[model samples]
Structures are given as C-alpha cells and as structure tokens.
Target: MEYTYYPGCSLEASSRGYDESVRFVFNALGQKLIELEDWNCCGATSYMSTKETISLVISARNLALAEKYGRDIVAPCSACYTILYKTNHILKNNPIMKAKVNQALKKDNLEYNLSLNVRHPLEVLVNDFGIEKIVSKALIRLDGVKMAQYYGCQIVRPDRGLDDKENPQMMDSLFEALGAENIYFPMKVRCCGGMLMTTYPDVALKLNKEILECAYGNGAELIVTTCPLCHVNLEAYQDKINKKFKKDFHIPILFFTQVLGLALGGTPKELGLNRNLIPFQLKKTALEATK
Candidate 1:
C-alpha cells in the first residue's frame, strides 16, 4: 500500500496535525506515503474563480509530478483534492483546455496526460485499505466517544462519486470500526463557509453556528472532519460563534486521522492531538493511563 502523498499547503501549516496523524495511522496500517517533492500550491478554490488557467496549470503540475512516481496521489485537504481532481477531470474531458493548460506547463517542463488518480486520504483508507484492516490494527477502542462525521462541502459536491452528496458515511464507517458511536448529524455535509471566514466573516460565523448547533444538538462529543478548513472554522470559530450567538459551544473538532491514530495505539503527542484548539482531555487521559 504505497501512494504519492500530497500534503498541500494547509497540511504543512495550520493542519500540520492532519499530516502527522495521517502518517502515523497509515504507517500503523503498514502503508507507505511517499510525499511529492517540490509540489506547489494547488491554487485552492479562490484562485480558480479569479485566475482559472493558472489555477488549472498549477494543479496540473501536481498531477504531472504524481504521474512521475507512477502511483496514485492521496491528498488530505478537501480543497486541494477538489481542485486537483477537478483539474484532472476537466483536462481529461476537454482536450482544448488540456492543450491550453499544457502550454502554461511547458515553461516548467510538466505536462498532464491524466495518468494518475487523485484521492483523498479518507477515500484511500475506506475504499482501498478496507475497514477490516483498520479494525484488526485497532489497539484502543473508542466505545464511549460519540462523534459527528463532518465531510463539509467540497469533497462530495460536483459529483466526485466518493460518497453520497448529502449524507456521507465513509467517516462514519471508519469511526464505527474504531468502536466510536456515530451521531446522526444532518448537517454533516453542509458548508463550513471556508475562506468566507476571512472574507465574509459575518456569514461565516452564522454558517459555522448552524453546523456547531446541529452537532451539539445531536449530542456529539466532538466533530471529525477530513478538510483542514472545516476543522479550523469549526474549532477556531466556536468562541466567536459563541460570542455572536450568546451561547457556549466548547465542542472539540478533530481530524478523523487523529482519532484513527489514537485507536491504533498512537499517543496524543505522537498524533499531534495537543495542537488542536479544542483539546481532547479524556482521550489524553485514557492514553496516559494506558501508558
């Protein structure tokens, strides 16, 4: 189980915990993640709207680099996955656009023939790696933890075929394998307002409040996400959301890989759990007690 891993920009900075936990969990499962060397930014969602060709070419360069490794590319960030995947899909379908993109890539000596597949880590773990493998490797059972699987908006939308558009169950299935109770959260696939947190913060706070309320109302102990932006928005904005809405929402938002790392006998520090804005004290205590 070896794949070229694309950490993207967010994973390297704010979402470093995701990169660490993803590496830890995958290593525990006997998988190798070879990171793409000298990979640039995927131009994210905003760049696509403003500079579509440059965005496509930038994303296409990553696709081309991954193809050099002759392995499928696994990206942890949903935004990066969406951008890269969308680029691949477009270049494969639209030959004229593909030629235009290649012209931009010619300066860097990169060309995308759409030879490699782009996958999110969640997709790789659930679909390719299988639940039984993860179950067999679990050393700590999360029996009492109630979790809400938040897939956010980008990953499932635009018909990516990874999971259901409205209600995704991939994270739910993974959590179930780790013995955690999956709360029925209707807002699992809702938007986190992403960069809107910076641009239109009022709307971002409002949307985040709705998501937080839904998760809290369903009695979720924490929210698990695959997207870095969603994690940051949900976890970091809780205080602001609380201030604006005149409520107290101290829910912990964690990456699915962090919990997966825990269930696989990884320590909190090993999985960068302490880096989370909202801490998981009980899990930390449990890990320490086991130690």
Candidate 2:
C-alpha cells in the first residue's frame, strides 16, 4: 500500500528522528510513503487560533497536493495531523469556508475538493495494516522493556479521532506487539502544554511534572509518544520539571515509529535513536533481553 506523506516543519528539524523512523518502519514493512512535492507548513496551533481562514487555506494547499496522488495522506506529527484533519472537517462541512479557501488557492493555481483522507501514521498501522502483520515482520522483540504510551491531545481530539480519545490503545497495542510492557497511564491523552513551553514555561513545567510523575510511578522505564511536541516537552524539559519539583526524573522519550523500527531489526543509528536528548540503550538492552 502507498500513501502521501506529510512530514510538516517539526519533522524536518526538531523531530528529524520521527521522520527517519517513520520512513524506516514503513519502508521495512514494504509500504511506500510518497512525500508530497514542495509541501508547506500545516499552520500549526497558533496560526489556526489567530487567523482561521489563513490556517485553513495553508492546510488546504497541502490537501490539494495529496489529492493529486489520490491516496490517503499520513501525517506523523500530532499537530500536523490535527491541523490537516481539521481543514478536511471544516471544508467538508462549511461551503462558505470552503469557497473562501478555494478562492485563495486559485491564486496559486490549486484547488482542494476534499477528496483525500488525512490519517495519522498510527491509524494507518493499526486500522489500515493489522497489528499481527506488524508483529510478524518484527525481527527484534522488546520482551522486558516497560513503556508508557503517551498520546498527548492533538491526534485524538475534536474531529481527528484516531483511537479511544480518553484512553487510546493504538500505541499501547503497538508497544505490546513489540513485546514491551505497556504501563497503565491515564494521562495518555492529556495536554502537554504544546507552545506553552515557550510562552509560559512555569505552567508547562508543572504540567510536564505531573505527566513525568505518572509515568515514573507506573514503572515505565521509557515514555513512547506519537507527537513531537509532547516528546519535546516531556524529554527536553525533564530537567526543568525536576528542578521545579525537586526530584530526579530521567525518562527517555521516543517516537512509536522509533520503537517499531528497532523491532524491525534496524540499527539504533538507522532509526535516529542516538539523536534523543536522553540516552536510550534500546539496542544494547532490548537486543540482549530478547537474545
């Protein structure tokens, strides 16, 4: 199977590991991920809240490109998934909004008929490709590792319902398929403060502290997430959260695709595991455990 891939801005820079692991996993599974040609930003969360029309138009431009392929579009980032999916929802429901967006796109000689489906990579893995198939292709198993699946808020909210909104099992299922223990994390879908980390770090640190405490309390050695922002807030700000709470929290955050890539027998460098701020010894650890 093939689909149009949209990596968005974060994937190109801050979350390059996610982009690498996503491509590695899907390519290893024999699925083609055709990237959209010259795709632009997804207008993020702030743009949508400030300039709704501009946000819709920007996201629609990407949909227009994907429509050319006439295949489902898979977005790896939670923010990109939410923004693109929201554009699809709004354009399909409101004719006036659609007309305005189309009118703006006409200048660039583009039009979006809302003919494509926007899907998260996890949705494609669980809903499109069965978990059994993923497991069958796995060459490395995570038998002893305990992972906390963190979903954040974007991927399964408003209209982009990828799984059980409050209690998502999609990533947890993937974790189990790899033979990793999925910790009972109730705040899987909670907000990770997104850009609030830049605007109000104190508030963001407080929220992240709660998430860290929960994951650590549940006996999770690592936190696996699908969203880049959540990964950044959780992984990058652990020191801040620790300082604020006066405790030592050293949990390494990884993208789900990274775990899947590892299970598919890709080396740690191949999956960009070394790029993480917190060192993850999955290659030496998980491999030895399975052996």
Candidate 3:
C-alpha cells in the first residue's frame, strides 16, 4: 500500500527518531510512503487558538497538495494527524471556510476538493494492514517484555473513530500480537501538558510525573507512545520530574514504531533507538531465541 506521508515540523527535527522509525517500519512491511511534496506546517494546536482562519489556510495547503496524489495522507505525529484531520473536517462541513481556504490556495495554483483522508499510521497499521499480517512478518518476538501503551490526548480525541477514545487498544493489540505484554495503564489517554513543558515547566513536570508514576506502578519496563510530544515530555523530562518529585524515574520512553521495527529485524541504530535519552535494548539472548 502506498500513501502520501506528512512529516510535519516536529518529525523533521525534535522527533527525527519517529520519522526515521516510521519510514523504516513501513518500508520493512513492503509498504510505500510518498512524502507530500513542498508540505508546510499543519499549524498545530497552538496556532488555531491564535487565528482560526489563517491556521486553517496554513494547514489546508498541504491537503491541497496531497489531493493531487489521490492517496490517503499518513501522518505519524499525533498533533499533525489531529490538525490535518480537523482541517479536513472543518472544510467539508463549513462551505464558507472551505471557500476561504480554497481561495488562499488559489494563489499558489492549488485547490482542495476535500478528496483526501487524513490517517494516523497506527490505524493504518493495525486496521488496514491487520495485526495478524504484521505478526506473520515479525523476525523477533517481544516474548515477556512489558510495556505501557501511551496514546497521549489528541490522537483519539475529537472523536476520530480510530479507536476507543478513552482506552485505545490498537497499540495493545499490536504489541500483544508480537508477543509483548501490555501492562494495565490508566493514564494512557492523559494529557502530557504539551507545549506547557515550555510555557509552564512545573505543570508539565507534574503531568509527566503522573504518567510515569502510573506506568512504573504498573510494572511497565518501558512506555510506548504514538505521539512525539508525549515522548519528549515523558522521556526528556525524567531528570526534572525526579528532582522535583524526589523520585528516581528512569523508565525508557519509546516510539511504537521503534519497537515494531525491532520485531521486523531492524537494528537499534536503524530504528533510531540510540537517539532516545533513556536508552533501551532488547536482550540479545531473547532475540537469538526468537530467531
């Protein structure tokens, strides 16, 4: 299967690991990702609060570009997925907004017919590709590895119908099918305070602390997430969270694609696992045993 890929801003820099792992995983699965050409930022959550129409126009440009491909647009970042999906929804429902957005696009010889479907890779992988098919392609099994499936807030929110809004099982089912154990985690859908990590470090630290505390309490060896922002908040803020809370939190936060790539015979370096702050490596013995 081939789809138009949108890397957004985060995946290009702060979340390069996700971009790399996502491309690697899809390629390994015999799928193709044709990156949307000349794509611009999706004007993430913050931009909408500043200016609604401008933000919609900024995001709609990418949709107009992707429409030419006549394929579903796959966005790996949760924020990008939500923004693009929301843009498509708004334009389709509100004719006035759609006219304004299309008029703006016309300046660049572009137009949006609302002929594209914005999708998250998680849904495309689990729903479209099928867990059994992915399991069949596994080169290594997770076996007894325990992990917490963290979906953050945006992906399932705004009722996208991808999975259960409250408790998503896509990640759980995929990991379980790969032989990994999904620990019971209640904070799976909790907010990670997002940009608050920059605007209000104290608040973000507390929110992250709660998430880490829940995963740790549930005996999760690692936390697997689909959102890059959540990964940053959880993994990058460990030290701050530990110092402020007087706790020693050292749990490894990994992108779901990184783990999935490992099962698909990808090395740690290939999957960008080495880039993680809290490094994670599967036991060689276990890998050899699986082979």
Candidate 4:
C-alpha cells in the first residue's frame, strides 16, 4: 500500500504531530508514503471563492506529480483533501474545465489527466488498511475514553461518498478497535470556519468555541478530526476562546491519525501531541473520568 504523500503546509509545519504520527502509523501498518516533491499550498478555502482557476491549477499540479509517479495521492490535511478532491472530481466531470486546467498547467510543463486518485488519509486507512488490522494492534486501550469523531466537512461531502454523509462511522470504528467508546453526534460534518480564523476571527472564535463546547457537552473530552484548517482554528484558538468566553476548557483537538498513533504504541512526542497549543490536561476530573 504505497501512496504519494501531500502534507500541504499546516501538517508539515504547525501540525508536526499530524505529519509525524501519520508517518509512524503508516509504517506501523506496513504502508509506504512517498511524499510529493516540490509541492505547494492547495489553496484551501479562499481559493474556491477568490480565484477558482488558480486554486484548481495549484491542486491540479499536485495531482500532475502524482500521475508522474502513477500512484494515488493521500492528503492528510482536510483542506488539502477537499481542494485536491474537488479539482480532481470537477476535472473528471467537465471536459472543457479539464482542458482549461490542463492548459493552465502548461506554464509548469505539467498536464493533468485526472488519473490521479486523491484520497484522504482516513479513507486510505479504512479502505486500504482495514479495521481488522487496526484492531489487531491494540497496545493502548482507549476503552475508557468515550470520544466524539468530528469530521468538520471536506472528507465525507460532495466528492466522495465513501462514508455515511449524515453519520460517519469510520472514525468510530477505529476508536472502537482501540477499545474506546464512540459517542455518535449529529454535528460531525458541521463546518469549523477553517481560514475564517484569519478573515473573520470573531466569528471563527465564536464558532470554534461552540464546536468544543458541543463536543464536550456531548461527552467527548477529545475531538478526532481530519482537517488541518479545523485543527488550527480549533486548537490554536483555545486560549482566545477561553478568554473570550470567560471559561476554561482543555479539550484536546487531535487528528484522527494522531489517535491511531497513540494506539500504535507511539508516545505523545512520536504522535506530536506536545505541539498542541492547549494542554490536553488529563489532570482534570472531567478528562480523568473518561480514562
């Protein structure tokens, strides 16, 4: 199971834990990831609204490289997953748009045939690795941890209907394999304001705060998400969220892969858990009760 790795930017730099643990887990599962060379940003949320062509071209370029290798590309970041998947899907559906995107690629001597299969890392794990394989490795049991799997859009919408759009169980299945309890919540696919953290931070913060509150209120001390944008907006905004709301909540925002990393017998450092802005403060009774 070898796939081209597209870390985008956030995972490589800010989400080192996501990047690190994903590598560790793939290796643990005997899967190889050949990271794309000279990859650039995937033009996240703003790309779709501001410059659609450039956004498609940027992601198309990344897929072009994947075609050169003739392997599927796995994007761990939610934004990268959505952007790349959108570009690939549209290019496959509209020939004229595909031609224009291909023409746009000529500037870099790249031509995209939409042959590259763009997949989210979560999809690869469930479809490629299989839940049985993950269940077989139960080193650290999370049986005590009742978790809420937060999808926050992207992975399960529009492009790939891999999981139940209304209710995704892939994350729950993985957590169940590790012996954790899955608390099903209807708000799994809700938006987390992504880059709006910069453009409209007040709204972003309010939204971010609500997300954590909702997750905790629903019986999850930890949130397992697949998007880098959501992770950034949710995790980095914790202090501001507490200050703004005048409350203290140390709910940990973890990548779905990071949870797998811990279950793979990797330490917090191996999983890049320490890089998080808010302490996952398990010392609190609310969190301690989960364990």
Candidate 5:
C-alpha cells in the first residue's frame, strides 16, 4: 500500500530515529511512503488554542496537498497526526470553517474537499499491513525483552478510532506477536506533559518521573512510544527528573518503529538505536536464538 508521508517537524529533527526507522520498516514491508512535497507544520496543539482559523488553514494546506495524491496521509508524529485529523474532521462537519479554509487555500491555487484521511503509522502498520504479515517478516524475536508501550495523550484521544482510547492494545498486540513481553503499564496513555516541559519544567519533570517510575517498577527495561514529544520528555529529562525527584532513573526510550525495524532485519545503527541517550542492547544470545 502507498500513502502520503508527513514527517512533521519533530521527525525531521529531534526524532530522526523515528524517521529513519519508519522509512526502513515500511520499505522492508514492501509498502511505499511518498513524502508530501512542500509540506508545512500541522499547526500543532498550541496554535489551535490561540489562532484557530490560522491553525486550521495551515493544517488543511497539508491535507489539500495530500488530497491531490488521492491517498491517505500517514503522519509519524502524534501531535501532527492529531492536528491533521482534527482539521479533517472540522472541515468536513463545519461548512463555515471549511469555506474559510478553502478560501485561504484558493490564493495558492489549492482546495480541500475533505477527501483525505490522516492516519498514524502505528494504525497503518497494525491495521493496514496486518500483524500476522509483520510477524512473518521478523528476522529477530524479542522473546524476553520487557517493554512499556507508551501511547501518551493525543493519539487515542478525541475518539480517533485508531485503538482503545483508555487502554490501547494495538502496540501491545503487535509487540506480543513479535514475542516481546508487554509489561502491564497503566500509564501507557497518560500525559507526558508535552510542551509543558518547556513552559513548566517542574510539572513536566514530575509527570515524566511518574511515567518512568511506573515503567521501571513494572520491570520494563525500555519504554517504547509513538509520540516524539513524549519520547523527548521521558528520555531527555531523566537527569533532571532524577535530580528533582531524588531518585535514579535511566530507562532507554525508543520509538516503536525502531524495535519493529530490528525485528524486520534492520541494524542498530540503521534504526538510529545508537543515538538514544540511554543505551539499549538486545542480548547476543537472544539474537542468535532468533536466527
């Protein structure tokens, strides 16, 4: 299957691992991801709170561009996925708002008929490609690798129909099929404090501390997430969280795609695993056992 790929800003920069692994995994699966040319930001969560129209217009522009491709637009970033999905939903239901967005697009010789679908790579992989197919392609099995699948706050919210909002199982099911142990993590869908990390460091640090503490307590060796912001908040702030909370926390935070790519025969360097702040390495015995 082919889809229009929108990497958003984070994937292009801070989450390069996600970008690399996403491209590697999709290509390995024999699926095609045609990146949307001249794509812009999805206006994220902040813009909606301030400039609603401008946010919708900017988000819709990407949708308008993707419409021309006549294919679903797959967004790797959770914030981008939620923003674009919201833009599609609002434009489809609100005629007045749709008119305003279309009028703005007209200046650029573009228009959105709300004919596009905004999807997350997780949903696309599990739903479109099928877990069985993914399992069949595995070159490595994560038999005893304990992982906490962190979905964060946005992806399942506003009823996206991607998975269970409160308790998502898509990631769990996929990893389980690949032989990874999915730890019982209740904080999987909890807020990772998102942009609050910049605005309110104390609050964000506490939030991330809780998440890491939960994962560690549950015996998770690593935390796998779908959101770039979540990954950053949980991974980059460990030292700060440790300092403030008076506790030691050093858990490897990884993108789900990175883990999946390893199963699909991708190398650690190729999947950007070496770039992680806290290092993680699967056992050589496990690797040989899978072979």
Candidate 6:
C-alpha cells in the first residue's frame, strides 16, 4: 500500500527519467511511494569499496530515516538497494559494525535500526502488491515483445537475502504478470561493466555494448534492467558503442519500472519513456519491454 523511497544520486540527475517513471507507475497502481524526508546518498558501491564503514554509515543514515518514517525504504536502483540492504543487514546482525556505524551516523543526527527494511521496488511489487493484483490492470501484454531482463550485478550478487544470489528470478513474475515474454538469459545477473563505467569509460562502453549484442543476437528486441547506473552505462553509451562497434544495432534499453508502468496503462510521459536519449521512434507495436 505505502512505502518510502530513496532515490540515489543518479535518479535525481542522470536517471530523472527513471525517477519520474517509477513515481507515475507506482502511483497509477494505487501504490503510494512517499520519499524519505531529507534523505541523503546511499554512498553507492564505490563508497563500500573505498571505506566499508563510511559507506555503511551513509547507507545507514538513509535506512535510519526510513525507520523514522515508519515504513520500509523501496529503492529502484539496484546499486542503491544493495548498499542499503547490505548495511541494514550488518546493522541488524553485526553488533560491532552496528555500534560503529551508529556513532558515525550520529554526525548527521541519525542512527541505523533494524526497525526499517530496505527493499527494491521489484520486491515490494510482488510482496506488497501481489502478483494477481498487478496483473489485474494490465492493458498491454508484452507477450509479443522479446526482451532480456537484466538484473546486472547488484540485485543478485552477495545474494543480499532477497533471492537466490546466483540464480535470480525476482523480476520474472512481474514480467509474466504484465504478459511480457522474458527470455531466459544466462547474463541476467552478469555485470554490465558498470563499475568500470566511471573509471574506465572505454571498457565500460565495450562491455555494455557487448551485453547489447549478446541479447539482440539471442532474439532480443530490447533489454530491461533496474539499476540507474546500469541504465546510464548501457543507454547513454549507445552512440559510442555503435561507433566503436561500427554497427547499427539500436535496441532500445528501458528501465524495469518504466516497462511495468507502460504495461499497467500508464502514459508514456508518466512512465518517463521519452526520457531516454537513445530515441525510441517506435509506437503502436509495444516493443519496449521490465526492472
């Protein structure tokens, strides 16, 4: 029914499209997403690698706020979700890390409590909204559209206690609920080279483009993913990938929430479908297909 959302840095800027779309989609579905008041960054995966405690503290601050709001935090970005959930797990299970993180978090007048749970929108949709409820209002069936549902790295790796770490079918039921044809791809949990996107643009570009090629070659007309970072690395790098590869494979990659919003009869604008810079010039056939 209701949940607080934490949109990481990418959603506010580079992933505004995702931000707007998730808002509209969930709203249309009678799901109320109240964002945490004055919520800060999740510190992302980078912070975790640089300094585990600092990253934990930052993520804990956000998670702590969700606790204050008395609602679980639903994060759309996979990276954001992972960091928040991981930190929450640590705070709940590891007393030493918990105390340290709470002390660091107090600098911002906050503390992490197991009282609040960190969830991805995909998880909330199924667990909270229920599969039958989501299917009840599907106006567009994605059965005709062949696409690869990529979870990238964050959603599955380290398991995070959400679903099977290596073999994840978290978003499958959602896609099926909307009548989308999801191709079982081995690379679903594979990395989009997103970690390298910032440090090594060229490498990131190549790897992301390769994911595109592999999916398309396997009869995929589009690729659906969750993480904003993954979306930026894959969707934003289209031109460079095209130029480097010297190929015209322009498969439109879309956010998982955007696709869910689309199938639920939400308008393209509401779903932020037009927010993509890659220019999806197709209409009527509903080729765009999931998070």
Q: Report the CA-based lDDT of candidate 4 relative to the real structure.
A: 0.82
Q: Clashes in model 6: which pairs?
A: 256-290, 256-291
Candidate 2 lDDT over residue span 3-118, tens digit each: 99999999999899999999999999999999999999999988988998999999999998789889999999999998898899989999999999999999999999989889
Off by over 4 Å in 2: 159-161, 283-285, 288-291
| Runs in model 5 lying further than 4 Å from the true structure | none
On lDDT, who's better, 1 or 2? Answer: 2
* Candidate 3 minimal-lDDT segment of 10 residues: 282-291
* Model 2 global lDDT (CA atoms, 0 to 1): 0.89
| Per-candidate local distance difference test | 0.89, 0.89, 0.93, 0.82, 0.93, 0.79
Q: Estimate the overall C-alpha local distance difference test score of candidate 1.
A: 0.89
Winner on TM-score (1 vs 4): 1
Stretches of candidate 6 above 4 Å error? 281-291
lDDT of 1 by residue, 1-291 (tens): 899999999988999999999999899999999999999999998889898788898889899878888899999999999999999999999999999999988898988788989888988998888998888878877876889899998888878777888888888988886678898899998999999999999999999999999999999999999899999999988989999999899999889899899888888898989899888855554444344
In model 3, how large is the Cα lDDT of residue 286? 51
Per-residue alpha-carbon lDDT of candidate 3 for residues 1-291, written as tens digits (9 for 90 to 100): 999999989988878889999999999999999998989999998998899999999999999999988999999999999999999999999999999988988999999999999999999999889999999999999988899999999999989877899998999999998989899999999999999999999899999999999999999999999999999999988998999999999999999999999999998888989889999988666586696
Is candidate 1 or 4 superior in lDDT? Answer: 1
For 162-203, candidate 6 gives per-residue lDDT tens digits of 777777776877786566677767778878887797798888
Off by over 4 Å in 1: 283-291
Which lDDT tens digits does candidate 5 get at residues 12-58?
A: 88999999999999999999999999999998988988998999999
